[model samples]
Target: MTGYRRVLAHLREDVLGVLEPGDGLPPERELAIRFGVARMTVRRALDELATEGLIDRLVGVGTFVAYPKRNIHVQLTSYTEEMTRRGMIPTATVLDFGAVAASDHVARQLRLEPGDAVLRYRRLFYADGQPMSVDENFLVPQHVPGMAKASPPPSLYRYLSEEYGLVIDWGEDTIEATSATPSLARLLTIDARDPLLKIERRAYVGRVIVDFSVSYYRADRYRLSVPLQRPRRAQQHRPVLRGR
Candidate 1:
C-alpha cells in the first residue's frame, strides 16, 4: 500500500476507533513522525477522511472527529417525531405567531380565497440543543382555532392531532439547495451565505389541504435519504400493413 493509504487506514481503524466525536486528533507533524511519512502524506490521508465525513478540519483550530449527519428519510413525519426516533431531544422556539390574511400563493395552497385569515407562525427547531432548522408555517384558521392565541406548541403536528383531531394523512415536499441570508444565518447560528437545504411542504388531511410550510435546514447537519425504484419497460406493438 502507498504511504498515504497506509496512513489513512491506520487513522480510520486505529485512531478514530478510539476517539469520540469532537475529540481532536494529533497534529500532522506528530502523525507523520509516528507513521514514518511526510507531513503532506499525512495531510492527504486526513483530506480523504474529511471528504468521507469522518472528520472535520477547522482552520487555525485543528482537526477533530465529526458528528454524524442526521438522516431525514422520505416519510411522512413531523420534525419532533423524526428527531425523537433518532434518539435526540427535539425542541422548538416560536419566533412569531399570529393570525394573518393569506396571500395569493398561500390562499391557493390552502384552497381559500385571497384575504382569508390564516394562522401564521415561524419557529426555530433544535435537536439535542443544536439549532437544526427554521420553519415558517401557514394554517387554515377555521380548522385550528385558538392556536394563534395560545402559546405555540413544540410540535404543531402533535398539537393538531390531539387538540383539533386533525391528523395529517400525507404530505408533499419540494426540496432544493439555497444559501442562507444574513438574518436567517444569525437565527440558525451559521455563517452568512452558507449552504442550506430548503423544503416547502403542503400537508393534507383526507382531501383537504390544512398546512403550508417552508423550512430551511443546515446542510452540514442534515441529509435526505430517498428510496427509488426503476420504471417498468413498455411493451412494443407491431403495426399491420393494410391490403389495397
Candidate 2:
C-alpha cells in the first residue's frame, strides 16, 4: 500500500480505539502534522473512513465516531427461519425476482445444464424491522415451479418442508470474507467497502439438490462457529511399544 494509506490505516485504528461514541476526532491539520503527512492525505483517509460509516465528518467541525454495528448470529439456517426460531418476526423485501440463464458458477453449484434457465430470487431480510441480511438464491425451475406465484411466505425452507413435502436432510456450505457491492451496501445501509461474510450454500432434500444460495452477511453483525471433536485414542492410532 502507499505510505499515505498506511498512515491513514494506523490513524484510523488509533482513532477508533480512543474515540468514545459520538466523540469528535482531532483536526485534519493536527492529524497531518502528528503523522508527518500532507493535509490532503489525512483528508482522503478521513473521507474513506466516513464513507464506511465508521465516522461522521462534519463540515465546520471535526469528525465523530458513530455507533458500533449490530451483532447478528448466523446459523446453518435461512435468515427467516433462524430469526423465527429466535421468536423474532422476520420480514423480507424482494429486491429482484425473475428467471435467468445459469452462469457457469451457478450451473456447477445447482447441477444445471449450461444455458438452462433458473429461477432467481434476491431479497433483503429483516428482523424486528432492522436489516439482517441479503439472500440471493438460485434454483431449478422444475423443482420449485410456480414458486414465484406461491404466497410469498417468510421462510422458504418451511414452504418446501410443509407444502412440498421436501425435507432438507442435509446441506454443504462455504463461508469467506468479501466486500459489499454498491447495491448491497445501499440495501444494508452500510459502506460498499465494508468487510462482510459471504456464504455459498447448496441445500439438499434427501439426495436431490433443491436450492443454491449466496448470502452476504454484515461482518459487524455476524459470526459463525463450527464445533470440532477430537478423535478417540483408539480411533486415532496404536502406540508403538519400546522395550526397556
Candidate 3:
C-alpha cells in the first residue's frame, strides 16, 4: 500500500479504539505533517474513512466520529423465530419469486447444470418497522416444483420441512464486510458506500443441498455471535459451586 493508504489504515484503527460521536479528528494539515505526506494525500485518506462510515466531514466544521454501530447476533434459525426471540416484530416484503438460470457459483453449490433453472426468492426483511436486511435465496426447482405458485408461509424452512418432508440437516455460512450497492443503499436508506455485512449460506438436507441464500445486513443493525470451543483440560476440570 502507498504511504497515504497506510496512514489511512492507521487512522481508522486508532479512531476505532477511541471514537465517539462528535469527537473531532486531527486537522488535515496536521495529519499530513504527522504522516510525512501531502495535504491532498491526507484528504484522500479522510475521504476513504468517510466512505467507510467511520467519520463524517462537514463543510465548515472538521470531521467527527460517526455513531457506534448496533451489534446483532446471527443464529441458525427461522427468521420468524429469530426476530420474535429478540422481541422485534418481523415483517417481510416479497420482491420477486421466479425460476432463473443459476450462475456458475449457484449451480455448483446446488450440484446442478451450470445454467440449470433454479427458483429464486427475493425479499426484504424488516424489524421493529425498520428495514434490516435483503435476502436473496436460490433453490433447485426440481426439488420444490411450483413453490413460486404456493403461498409462502411465515418461514421458508418451516414450510419446506412441513410441506415437502425435506429435513434440513445443516448449513454452512460465511460473513464478511462489503459496501452497499447503490440500489441497496436506496432500499436501506443508507449511504451507498457504507460498510455492510454480507452473508452467504448454503443449507443441506441429507446429501442434497436444499437452498442457497445471500443476505446483506446493515452494519449498524446486525452482528453475528459464534460459540467458541472450550479446551479439553478445562472441560475435564470440576468447578465447586456454593449453594444458593
Candidate 4:
C-alpha cells in the first residue's frame, strides 16, 4: 500500500471508527509527523475520509467525525410499498393535484396533442417521518377517470390496478446523479449543491402510455442497486427481459 493508504487504514481502524460524532481529528501536520509520512499524504487520506462521510471538514475550523449515511436498496415497488416492507411509516403528501394544461414535451410522452388535458400529481414522499423524495407525475386525463379533481392517491400503482383496472405492463426508467435545485433543496432540507438521485420514468399499459414521472431522491438516505448473476446456459440462448 502507498504511504497515504497505510495512513488512511490506520486512521479508519484505530481512530475514526472509535471517535464520536463531532470529535476532531489531528491536524494534517500532526498526523504526518505521527505516521512519518509527507503532509500531502495525510491530507489526501483525510480528503478521502471526508468524501466517505466518516469525517466533516469545516473551513477555518477543523475536520470532525460525522454520522454514517443510510443506504436504501432500489426495488421494483411503489415508495409506499417498499417503505412499508422495510417497517417504515410511509406517507405521501399531495403538494399539487389537479388537471393542468400540458406542455409539448408532456403531451408527447402521454401520446396527446400539445393542448390536450393532463392530470398533474405532485407529492412529497416521507418515510419514517423524514422527507425522502419528491415526485411529479403527469397522466393522460381520460385514462384515469375523475383523477382531475381527486386527491392524490397514496399508492398510485395500487389505485390504478384496483380502481381503474390499469396495471403498468412496462416502464422505461433513467437514473442519474445531480445537484439539488433551490426549490428541491428547500423541500428536502438539504444544501443546493448537495448530490441527489434523479429518476425519470414513463409507464405504459401494453402499447398505451399511462404516466410520466420525474423524481428527485435524497442521495444521503437512498441508494440504487441492481441484482446481477452469471448468465444461465439456457437463459443465454433465449434471454427473457425483466423489469425491476
Candidate that would win on TM-score: 1
Number of clashing residue pairs, candidate 1: 0
Judge candidate 1 against the unseen true structure and give its global Cα lDDT, from 0 to 1.
0.83
Off by over 4 Å in 2: 1-78, 84-88, 230-244
* Per-residue lDDT of 183 in model 3: 92
TM-score of each: 0.79, 0.64, 0.66, 0.72
Write candidate 2's Cα lDDT for 150-229 as tens digits.
Answer: 65555667777777777666667778899989988999888788878898878777668888998888766556655456
Clashing pairs in 1: none
For model 1, residues 128-147, the per-residue Cα lDDT tens digits are: 99898899989998898778
Global lDDT scores for all candidate models: 0.83, 0.74, 0.78, 0.78
Model 3 superposed RMSD (Cα): 10.2
Candidate 3 Cα lDDT to native:
0.78
lDDT of 4 by residue, 79-151 (tens): 7667777788888788898888899988877778998889888888888778888999898878988877666
Off by over 4 Å in 1: 13-36, 57-64, 113-115, 229-244
Model 1: lowest-lDDT 10 consecutive positions: 235-244
Model 4 worst lDDT run, 10 consecutive residues: 235-244
* Candidate 3 clash pair list: 72-223
Model 1 vs truth, CA RMSD: 9.4
Q: lDDT (0-100) at residue 205 of candidate 2?
A: 73
